[model samples]
Target chain A: MQGKAVVPATRRRRPSSPDGLVLLLLAVPGIAWFSVFAYGPMAGLVVAFKDFNVRDGIFGSPWNGFANFRYFLTSGDAVTIIVNTLFLNALFLSASLLAGLILALMLNEIRGSLYRRFMQSTIFFPYFVSPIVISIMLQVILSGVGGSGGALNNLLSVIDLPQLSWYTEPGAWPWILTIVKVWQLGGYTSVIFLAAITAISEEVYEAAAIDGASRARMALSITTPLLLPTLGVLLVLGVGRIFFGDFATIYAIVQDNGILFPTTDVIDTYVFRSLRTIGDFGTTAAIGLFQSVVGFFFVTAAVLVQRRFHKESSIL
Target chain B: MSTTGYNESLLDHEAREADKPAARRRARRRPEPFTVASHIVVTLFGLFCLIPLWMIIAGSFTDETVLARQGYSLFPNPFSLAAYELLFSGQSLLNGYVASLFITLVGTILSVSSTASLAWVIARRLPWISRPLTVFAYVPMLFHGGLVPLYLLVTQVLSLSNSWFAVILPILLAPFLVFITVSFFRQLPEEILDAARIDGAGELRIFFQIVLPLSKPILAVLGLFYAVTYWNEWFMALLFVSDPDKYPLQLILQNLIANVTNATSLPGATAAQAAAPVYQLRFAMTVLTVGPILLAYPFAQRFFVKGITLGATKG
Candidate 1:
């Protein structure tokens, strides 16, 4: 009986044909939903090249053949919007990386488990807070009128410094937005790095200690080097997303604050404004297509490069 | 054993290492100045994170005159419940709450069920379907047709505009959640599944009766994620729904904030109301919008941590 059982287990039979069919049936709803929502829109991207009239409809519209693309390219806001998007994303990426790494290293150095966990939870709280709320909080804290005697102004008066109008200052928004982004995201990102640090085998640290390596030396030589793969993957992914501005954050914080538009406006807000205000379906679609294509290429190139260097960590 | 249990054991083993022989333990636990500096820095940073939330709460309860005069304080000298009274007095706030609750609860259920079922099928490595299905799932993550086409599809084709369904459907089954669920389902032991199959349990039975029962933690984690996302969502309403009555809490809060800010300059009853109470009202609205999630956060923090660890390590 034991021999027979061993033989059957070792020579495990293929699943029956009907089971395969059952699995397919189970997957049908998800597939159908994706087909409508995801793939169908992908197929509809052709509308970007067409003059999409309501009467003519999506596919029925006459082909305009790059006219939409030409319109956006020539609009002159294109360069500013794209440049703002890339520059802001780059700034955010570096700030968030630096802040997250510093916090992770700091958190790792602390010895009390309860203190570490409490700090981790407190810092991570902001990631879950809505951008809308953050915007409101910012207004309350910074707006000269909305926050009549706003917190910042109050502090400035106490310190004998002149109160500055925060919202109207376009020059300050890039820095303000970068700081807010880092504050919101740094802790959450650091948790990833912390996990990576924790996953490092203790034997390596023990061996380093035995060799008379100090804590700082071990962290620099052992922990940081061992953490390189995780850092590398995150950095590559961050670069890939350089073109994709966070729409929610930008929109909520800088809403109709036209003075700040020169500095804060990004590709996402540009497309959204065009679509909503001008109701230009074709041009908006063209810009969307441009972003999608560019993003796809960037991500693919990153993944390829990642695969070349560290095949095991390549997402694909 | 649970992943947390495994981690705790690892930590315990390290602690044991530090507790061994006095000389070695002292060497390991050297009193470095950096430790003191790090604690100070981390504690200050933690306070920095908490201060905004603290201000929001304090500003909400402070007397309107005091709040305007004081500009938000750690402790409201003259506390008032007027904001709460105003929030509760309105029918609109209640309506917004009901709309948001319905959307979040129903959306999370639909999202979890669809994502889990699909993830299970793909994770099973079934004949002729798994590979293509994976590619199908992943394609959306890499290449979306962009928001224009999706908006067009939802409004013109599906005709779901001006309804709560519009808010729910767009976010129903995110590819990221599907991938997370897939990775989690894959971690389940294959031997147990084979044993169940050999016991004549059908695929449906195995999935519903066995796999789901074993996946409580991951499902709870994913459910909290979906709930928070649906609860926080205002973009869908901004794009699709126009009816003020159907506006979710976040959208209503957004509009209220805009109105309050705009009212400050305009001369009218709105400006009169905006003079003192508006500051408190803004804080009140913020608290109301974020209050439920904040209250629930500590209970869900464990699962949230686990979820992040799962995504980070596995991805």
Candidate 2:
């Protein structure tokens, strides 16, 4: 039966006809999914411009014509949330990049397989668990008098210093969140840089070595200079996402803790609270639409910049 | 410049270590200040990653009173399984496990297959459909209808408030992964595909029999990415799932941790709150939730590393 089928197919041999249709058939489910889930919600973005009510559907709702946008813009929460998002993402972005580059350079210098692998594995271990797990685990160490003095407090008291409430202090969270982001993503990012460094060809290092360049000096002069493009690309990509925040990390760790919201809350968490808790769709969608439009411009600019830098690298 | 630079270097390093005189290598390598400092710094960073997790395990074993007093020591003083006892005493944990497991398994399979099928279409770049399809997929990556509509669509319109479909369907296809997989597929030996076509094999047969078999590494990596994502799905559950029994492990962990924090942070907490073993239970819950991912890390490490590097550092 297979042989006979093959014989007929061979005789027919229509290159694009059979494959194209079957391929389209294969793609129907995904297209439908994207349409309903992705584009459907996109069309429903009209809620940003409407006084949305659950009863009157998204389209049936009265068009408010920038009232939602105006309300959000005038509302004091706009500047705070937008500033918080940019500031926090900026902290995470720079810290992770620096941490990743340093770790990568260090890892690259180590030729011993076992120790390097062990360190790589250990550093990368944090990526496996969610920030919720990390935050909970570290809470034991970071807690203060209000929550039963944790390890840091214990150490501080031993040193005749004051025990600080880590969680309640909004001032400490920006640095705390930055540290956590580095700890979680540092290893993963380092591995990427290491891959780039590995492809730098042993000849470059050997040639520098014969020229009497020290390892540290070579790393500074040779490796760091070579990493500029990657660093720049990552920076541009990070800029594109400046309006977004690590909602998962923030929400998981902070979890409706109103005390930390002033510093830790970003546009994402704000929108989430509005949609879920406050039940304010019009204002929330207005904020969402704002983020989307601004985010689209940033992304487009990033792609354009990337295309100018390396034509083949642009997503567009 | 092969993409397997890290793996190849690792193998090369191992072989060198095996054959070379370690005593000689160490003697030469010992005096370098740079090497010494890097070893110390990287080693400390490694310990920094492991210590908190280790402390949590130790804290889970410690008695609640001891934990409160000492703030989590390396060895559990007056070790007690009270947290374990409390954890196993409920059916909710089991339900969390079941829900998480089912979703991760089913969701990863569906996501990966959908991604692969769509990715193959994009990779083929047929004149008529591929470009439009590509735009349809990629546009969502940049701008999407915001959370209000997504929530309303899932909850009110689709009425999937408590269904697993609500969570899985939203994230079923990632354009980023589709693009990466498309790139991977496009690099295949086209001559083999051409030969198969000339020999009267249907495109479907060629894809199933040859292309997919050849695409295992990328698929495995992509599947691992999806599985990790599905396993860590808490945000969607927060949005859609309300039934405690249906909660994923992450949502359970989030709620459990939140409750514990609330309980502990109360001013002049009642005796019942103090005696509840909240500290140990918190750590214990974290351990249970993270246990599987940690266990799978060693096996999945290469694939995970490959997937990220492939996606992020590509030209």
Maximum-DockQ candidate: 2
Report the C-alpha displacement of residue A161, candidate 2, in angstroms: 3.0
For model 1 the TM-score comes to 0.92
**Listed models, DockQ each:** 0.45, 0.48
Clashing pairs in 1: none
lDDT by residue (A146-246, candidate 1, tens digit) is 44566788899999999988887899899989988887988898888887887677677678788988777866788788888888888888888888999
lDDT of 2 by residue, B1-315 (tens): 123533454245334434333432432434477877888889989988888898888888988777766566889888888888777877777888998998899999999988998888878878787888889888998898888989889988899998877778888888888888888787776766766765766667878887887787789988998998898888888889988778888877787677764543222234665667667777787888889998988888877777776776552
User: Per-model TM-score of chain A alone?
Assistant: 0.92, 0.92
Residue B42 C-alpha lDDT in model 1: 86
Tell me the spans in candidate 1 whose CA falls farther than 4 Å from its real position: A1-14, A144-149, B1-30, B261-276
